[model samples]
Target: MRGAKSAKWVVGAVIVALAATACGGDNKDDKPTGAGKAGGTFSLGLVEPVSIDPVNAQESEGILVTDNLFTGLYEPTADGKVIPALATSKTVSDDGKTWTFKIKPGTKFTNGEIVNAEAFIRGWTRLAAKASASDVATPNVGGIDGFEALQKGTATTFSGLTAPDENTLQVKLTTPDFEFDVKTTHTSMSPVPKVAGAGKNQAYNDAPIGNGPFKMSGKWEHNKSITLVRNDDYGLTKAHLDTVKISILNSANAAQLEYQGFQSGQFDWARMPTAQLTSAKAKYTAQNEWIQADTSGMNYLLPITENGPLKTAKARQAISYAIDRDAIIAGVFQGMQTKSTTILPPSFKDVYQKDLCVSCIKQDKDKAKSLAAEAGLKPGDELHIGFNTGGGHEEWVQAVVQQIKDVLGLNVKMDAKPFKELLAAQQAPGATGAYRFAWGADYPTPDNFLFPLLDSKSINKDASGKVQGDNRGRYNNPAFDALVEKARSTKDSAARNEVYKQAEKLAMDDQALIPLWNRTQFRLVNTKKFTGGAMDFHEDPNLAEISAK
Candidate 1:
């Protein structure tokens, strides 16, 4: 039921295609080309469908397209620094509860809609609307003043948000959030066409309007293809290519397509399969292609539920010890993954605790049995585990389940359902089931990693009036919640680090979740053709400066 914060690597050191195109003739010059000079069409492959609305899109590929199609009020720099995009400058109140932004002049949407303070207000308000069901805004912006109240039917409007003038916008929060600038990088906070925000329907979905580098030219849903043309009217800057096409494909077939050259010039770039890493290196290296290993951006795991046999701390710890992560990473993952000690990846500097727990680093079969015995579990006790097979990766899930059965004496039952159904079941209160899930950092903050999954306040009822199932296991500890909240409010690095240190300890002690391998970002690209901007979790396949050689 866990949503991917960004993208995933299909293989080791095999680069995922950001965008690619083949030209009729090769140009050996290494110089950059002018806008629209690279006239050929580029085709990028995505594993998942781009069904989510652009305003609330969460997938990495979706974000890449959205970035080219829209511009946010602010954009994150390469080093995770925030700089102005739509807004020229911003001022903060002495109390730190209010922020005033000065809108940049001459900013306009692709549909000729003027970019003003009112546009920002309208866009954010629409995102916070209950009808939107926007995953991006619900969890991130709910903390803003009057936002949660509106969602709960206690308030009719966002009293904290005000647009007093055409170019002046003010935002009031319930409390000061030091990471407000970082939070703005999310798509929910990005400005959208005022018309598209009117209602959720085909008009909004079919005709997405934005002020980005590219605009949607055509879409073929059944064929899984989207055509994007350069937004010539975009005032900021022009794109190098005239058109870019994105095609959705099965993960298993992506690498094969690249190797066969079926779409050779059309599919100049692709993510090489991990199984073919040795062959790819031998083949592509001779051609002088770029191949590198990028760190997996987040931690992936199968969380144990509190209402199940894993309710006991010993049982939960025992489950963690039962499966050998090294074997899973080597055999199932082909050494493309790294064992994670902390919930956060090593790429995240401020929040990741390097020395949290050394003993839990490796799996020990004897230790797992001893812990299960301590939990007072007799023979024949059933352990029910759930996983989403429709989202893909059924093989990995089956392997993990088999390993657990072989190592632990407990009887295990597996339920593999479609992602949507499994997600719904996971969120249903009193629904005790363990499932495979992964968490990617929304923003580069410890609070981002700790809050949504663990915080007690995050739990709520769905549209059906049933208890909303964020904390699927009903695992609640006020002390842990308080520690996370403290970290969220503090601006000091040392104070926030100390709070996260304590919070990590509490989470590990309860054994509510298992720490798995940290993911690495991998993408295959024709370096000779396109150039500029390094890839990162925040922005994959930096489209801003990419071009055809």
Candidate 2:
């Protein structure tokens, strides 16, 4: 889930959520047993989350916490199929701009509050406020009517959202979106209790009362651990595990520590560090203790476009041409990742263009030199590459820096900080030259991948010019924005995908963001002791489905 990475819209964005299996096929063996012996505790090792608040969860760690703490109108299965959870059924208007969902009756939060239509309405309105502030709001409801007014703080509630009855929730969108139900699967679209208030309520965020399969056992312990117990009153698929304990360890070698903990039988689930992936496979594969799943997350470099040494397209293209992704994957990642040449992953088969990034597929020192010189870069100029520490990124980022030095002959430096600090720096205008970032899918659509990360409209700036939107790099292109809009409105999947492909090409040709590699999730699990614990499309474990064997 950490590839939901240092940030989510850096992980969570919305063209609209797409069905994972339809777009990209995952491991067929990924099916976990839904019926298993219950009543066992499952322990996992994890990195610290920035926030567990669904509205503010922008990174992978935070997203994991929210995933367990809440259930939305629709929820995705392990393979990414969107199914009704809080809602039993849905219908669309003739024009396709209006949608009404029938909320499942009698569902209640752990706190005994009813999970009615108002709960979802309040939750979405609160999410809009957070999105307005440039905080992490996913499944961007920007398509909904009155969203702009709500986001701009001009409205107190969403005019598009209305409760016709206690169990009926209706939404009016400015544009027709047939896949709106799929977008409801996001945690950001989950219902929240009244105590969550209308903004960042620290008390509620610390100990959220959820209507999901699990409930927080106590308050979050912050850098230490967070515990969850099964919510017996859950209305949908009930959790089989009695308790889920997530131990947060954020040391410099956190992933290594997690692997060690797994070996010592301290954790039922753990992530394999890149340094030990090969040895882990050798040791665990024979025992069926290792699981490798494909996720839609993409690791890349985000260059500050507004200002910096990477201000020009040629400079960004030069950086993309200089790095050797194969060496990093082979030497640092132990050949566990796939090199990427485009914004969309291969899973988006209908729209993905393999060779769209002409300069990224292979390293070209001559091309790098020419582009660097064209952008007025000299051999000795200092170019800083910033990244988050303690997330198994230091090694690969160092390799990238070395390649840039060797290829462009620049005085490259590494700027490493804590994940939170690095995120802040990346969002600030020109605070750093370039920083590492990754994005995982919320749903399967190309719009989900393209619009939020590249659209100029998605770029919201504060008075001080810091990015408050998902467009952290603050790239502005009227032509690119037009294509994204065209795709957003097109109802036919094939035609829409064509427009999306064009948009992706435009951004890539400009070298808007340097594509590195697609993520392959490596996990360690005690298969003999547990059943039904598997990675979802976002690389998060299906904690609700896990049970003792």
Candidate 3:
């Protein structure tokens, strides 16, 4: 999932402090710049790239930029319900195998290309075509009928998809999927102009043509910074902002920027630095709004290689038992985390299993040592671990390595590499050993958590012919896979939950991956400058409703 998970809640906590600091402004008049202004510019500092292309993007920062510059057929509501965006309404067959959508009228791309039935066909077909090399397309559309066949080069046509008119599009599925609407909100479903850019993937990166409220003005240094000007041709007049500027700011310097007021009144909103939460609260007292919500995301220490000393199930369980997750939360996050018992967070009320705790791998140094010995590991076995300094809980990573070294009596080496390099290494097949990374919900479903992270088949050869991205660990268990598949195919929610519960138990017992904690979503917006309800899914500052005080 491309949403912020761990940092969202922490950011929300800081927002609360910001809200306390700044008070008494009506929510309506909190926008930093008055609506309809054309000259002033608002700058946003992001921890990652503000990439224009949706295919190669991975983080929420990039998605935020996409959301502002792109429009999809559907979007998710605050309650996790799907609502129309480019499409007016959709109808599903009683058996749930067929879906038909009525496209919204009078929509036009920024290039003045009138959106029609052909546009929908062209966009989806392009995404479905492996020749496009679209990363977002393959995963999101793989569930549709003939999609897999198309990707495998056995099919020339997408059997599941059809567009009969400029205003209507239809999809025929092989089986019933209850989460179809939720899936449609993904970026893969976003419409793009057919002749907007050249070269397969270069077009989206260089110039994006979407029927959104904003149009890409320019991109600098391959998405380090991006510029977007208001799409004056847009049909919606409610979008008050004239332009938006996004700048890439490393997490380390985010605090300094916020503390220095570089973004305070000049820009409407910016991520509050973790170290400045308290001080920001005191400084912006009564002029800010901070909110926190469970993001349904998990951060874990994943073991990459399922061979060697850590390959045995018992050995993995022992390693899990040795680390103190509570200490990591307190010391690293400053009490900003909830201990996770399972892969799915409690926010997913229906599918999150509360009863199953088969391998409640709590802190037990002695037990871990015994299990390691049982796996035939000598006292001097070398265990190598790695993490990324580019994103997430650096302190936690250091503390985990220390705990493993001290408790296991093993020689341990830890490598903290750059974020991008670490991501590349993690995606490389046959890479022995695991690293720490945060998993955010792509959608608000337990299937999102289990299928992508644990499924054996999710691994695939990237452009370089190396197995990459999800399923990097290459950990596989037939029992676990069966349970997940059963859960997916079964329509009965209760039955699916039961199967998922079993899957969770098996994952825990086998120690497939260590469950760290469910992260909280956090946003600190200066209420004096901007006002709107915060979103748990993404930081979507609704500009239409905001005004300058």
Candidate 4:
């Protein structure tokens, strides 16, 4: 769900430009399978992942690696449907609080362990436990009964989870949710093999044994690369490619380097740096090898509300009103990015509302100056903006800093740190006033965009009051929270979406976060060397379907 954290965020590109592109695979044989020439390495570029272990892998880089290494009970399709993968059938109770899943029998992890109901139980239980240090556990599975107990370390397992037999998993939730199956598609919910051992095991993180179409060929070479070979014993749709090779590039010029690698034949699929996008598209588009897609990711600025100059909504709105998104998108991103008018991305067309945030309009220097004056902020007041380096954010951040200075007559400071360090700073007590934020939907639902990222319950505070979780800005509105809850408990889809729209409106009215632009995935592929390589609904490469040309 963490998008920009991907290595230069290369591996997270989606596809909307090429309608004729073969993404999933060609099932021309009229059979439920993916088959093709099967013996060659398919190489691509990647940034070093934070962690590949299912419990801790939340960023796009780590999640991309995990997707190839493990197939969950369900897989997200290009059409935004959660289709059965490891599980065959699911049934729900009338109250909608109880659900049962029938796992595919005899499915084996690469290490020869059975991926049964107990494996899913153990994996989810570990993810929910605070000792596991999983970032996804609470946001994705907090609806399960006793989740709070696990977070407090008072329970070792989820009280709502039960394995009726080797193949059956029964779950009880504290509240009704129709999209529980969709949430299971997340990497953290993937079944962990028994060999993984317990409690954030490092060995397993290095080389995980998985039950997918591919398995790790060897231990992950940190800051280097990772290679995966086809899982010969995999039970479902077989893979067309024999191996997947991912090169890890984390230098400040990673985007430039990745583009160069693609040109030199070092990569079959590569992300185009914004600087080279114009020329790359001009050349590759003619060859039908260019890809520009609308991603579910959104880039924003979180104005820390707990303390600092941005404590008031007026100050935050002033900041939002000052920046020129169209100018930045055209000047810096080479017209490759779209200016965002709302918190929701373009992919959520049905539920998305135009100009949902009144403060989200284009740059209005007069408005910004007036709002800042009302908030008692003026010239010479130091405004700090925090961001991470090596993620293609510096140029835009500088542009934003300059705009704020010219419009509001404020002295702005740019605090840049490494990605991981920036994340630590965001969670610490009295964090930065404003920081860069990027998120991809964990699932294709309005709740996926709202609840975990904005809801009050998503924020976790320790004894000393250090805040953690996705609500990094610490913005809380009971009215917004109430609307989100109403939406979640609603069984009807149309009614649920209506409530979500209201919640978004309330949050935006408070200027919860400064919406910059919806993310656009840019890539150049060597069609001569690869086929069936395309981005799926999750904005992930469909590795299993790709084959060497």
Candidate 5:
């Protein structure tokens, strides 16, 4: 969940919740029944991989593939914890500016290259190279001492990084970031063998070598499928499944096709389409093969430009209070997902400050109309709403459009574009006044949610001079930014969380963006064939952890 990756808009941006709140140790109810029989090909239906190159991959589909293919220093747990992966343990200096990682002994990449500090150095060197231009790694990599030099082609290695031995790696950051370790969990830090390394090279993107439980068995078929075989030489307890077949059924009816495959035993698992949820539940009511997860992410509607009718904070607040989150959940998601009252999920319940948007979530149409009138908007006025296609957003977007019309009496005329074109449009100057959006955490920290999407410093001007960040909304508040900056600089966890609460409250007061329901995922799995696999928010049960029953 780290790196500067932002490609999640194609799928849904998965902003992981802050550590100790929404992370790790969340799956206590699922008991481990010893690894079942090995040697079975687990079939999964997924969209085509955007890029198999771990460093360049940013979307959920690519992450799903690489999570099993590559290993990083840390990995996310179901309960929202960042636990050690490649490293035995990580230690921080008293100053909190330096970190020391104790590497696991005898780990090796799929290509037989020894996994060591130099491996990481080489991997990062490639990513930092000017020619590589790794959009996903640029931001956090800049946190390192010599990263600027590396990016500018003046240095061959990070000055902050040192390896006294193969087993020891030390890094010095430009600033003190206690939650920095969680950033290492991203695939950007996954060590790649020099021979198999390629940032945008088609060869490497086609079949990248990995150090995880599985390795690419063959070339990635264009818009079709990819196969992964067990990595026998992996250091950890080996993967149970002998192979994994990831098929790309890109039909507009892909979900239904996959579900049909599951019904016909052609596929072992599939995600239930939202459109078919009601019927699917009825058809499979007695079957206990349902796998559901409350993924760590939130959805909100953004006002991409400030020059339109939604320019006023009151107009924005009206929209925020206007969304009937409960009705939206029931109408759009069939009640599979729950309404999100806070930007931060309940995973961080202690600090989420659910009371912040109590009135907004109350669905009081009168308050919304009053807020609208304050913005000089009247009943029957047209409100422009924009969104991107793909990722099954149509059905839900339509439902949301209808909700605004029925509740607020506003004419919600939506401009829908393909994901890429929509992003481009959103970034264009004088573009959208209202845009549907979502954000997933780059790291498991409140800073990921607050700073990137809110802090003015993160904002940048596009070609058309339109300001953008993940904030896309162009929502800015100096007070909120100050609170967020304080939260970032503070090392005390309690103080930081409290600061975040205040910051979140300030943002809620502005009501620049409307919070929608936090989406849930439901995948149908063959229970008898897979015994120990447990699904979670970010991704499904790890392929390594799944076994034939």
Candidate 6:
């Protein structure tokens, strides 16, 4: 696949915190049958999702809801493969610029509308339309031919798309992107009504239509709960659970509360909050039911570029080399996560190349001080660090501050801003000092992991050319960018891996970002009642595969 050309990125936020756990067996009027049985109910905990609209929702909190509510053209397997879902089969043309898909027979949305090629075409067209206002969505879909023009209002419709008949969908691309299947994992192709309504319809956002195994039973109650019932006509895999309830507990201590709720038998699945990990580990370990997997996103740090010492890569490397990742893991995360050296998560065993980051694997106070001095930094320099509004950042803030002070003799000032304000501040020219970076998979490919967030092409500019895209720090290097572009355009798996490894080394050598740790999902399922719940590498829980034990 010709890979990501996306300098412009789209909708989504990484899931930041873990869930809470509690203990007890609460009474219920009905008990579900064992795993593999035909019917039962399952409940899980969540922080509030921003939107249930498949095209608009970006964060994982919203994905959990949307994944259940709709099925995309392709389904991601737990191991990182993209296979057909709504699509019966897909084939690429000789030139690799066109793709044709065969829709599964008899697929229909909850509204009883046929999920034909036109349905798919309309969904894609609407997503790229000028009025969608889908900041989180437009970037992902705009890579298609003419979609970008449609979003820019230069074109009324995407000329790249055509549905010659009811069942066949054809797509023409401007470039040869072999990894296009990976992009299909996003829900931008979830077929909509023949005549879609205008922006943000309250009725449409809630109780939305889908062709997935489950259907929304009622309107989504923001920061409260969303209820779902099974679609008996779902054409693919059988939906073992009769119902699913997602409780949105937007409390300051939501993670801790989920701990208590799940232990009380209120939640069928929940995360073991880091706050209670120490206390719950012994008991949960004894039950032999706790699940732990490295959710394939990254927890890293970025340094802003416009004016400061960070403009010099040496200063950034000095900062990266001085930090103590172990202390953060021991103090803040309780030693559950694996150390990260690059943006690629350790879970992609074959794709991630070890030993790619130079002078970053271990803390070296002497080397850090030397590098800082070379970058023109003297003692008592006040370093400004920015973070989004939240409670859990205090310990991390304190740790990084103390580390910098001890190693480089620098003073640290922390800036806390609301989420919206933080995003704006980060994008402003030469203003954002330093901030954190967390990226969950928008797709399963390594290119999806490396591009947009780190590429030079993603750097936005005005008429005057000040950097703006998500590469907030403006870390631009020609050699690095070439390697990345080569990796994106290559088709052979071995060639892709070879080029990616080179790009990974080049990126970290420049200290594109200081990789801190791999995300670990502290998963807990009610073993007595629920027996099958698995998360794909993207961390989407497969609802169709879930069942009551």
Winning candidate number (TM-score): 4
Best by lDDT: 4
Q: Candidate 2's residue-wise lDDT over 318-393, tens digit each? A: 9999998888888998787889999887766778799788888999989999999999989999887888777788
The TM-scores, one per candidate, come to 0.85, 0.93, 0.85, 0.93, 0.85, 0.85
Clashing residue pair totals per candidate (backbone < 3 A) = 12, 8, 33, 1, 14, 18
Could you tell me the TM-score of candidate 1?
Answer: 0.85
Lowest-scoring 10 consecutive residues by lDDT in candidate 3? 17-26
Query: lDDT by residue for model 1 over 1-549, one digit each (tens)?
Result: 144325211112434332221111222343323442445456666545343355456556566666667776776544344566676777876655677888766767878988788777777777676666554554567667878776665765677888878888888888766666666756557677667754375666655787776788864353366678877666564566677777755434544554444227656456555556566666766665644544435554545444667777788777777777788778866776777777656666666777454435888888888888998754577877776542334556677677778877667778866444565666665565367766655455666666666766656556664434245555678999889777767777688788887897787677756776776544455555665423544435555456676
Judged by whole-model lDDT over C-alpha atoms, candidate 2 comes out at: 0.77
Model 5, position 288, has a per-residue lDDT of 65
- What number of backbone clashes does candidate 2 have, counting pairs of residues 3 or more apart or in separate chains? 8
Compared with the true structure, what per-residue lDDT tens digits does model 3 show for residues 328-382?
A: 7777766767777787777777767663433343688888888888977666788
lDDT of each: 0.62, 0.77, 0.61, 0.78, 0.68, 0.67
Q: Return whichever of 1 and 5 wins on lDDT.
A: 5
Better of 2 and 5 by TM-score: 2
lDDT score, residue 406, model 2?
92
Better of 2 and 3 by TM-score: 2
Model 5 alpha-carbon miss at residue 191, Å: 1.4
lDDT of 5: 0.68
Better of 4 and 6 by lDDT: 4
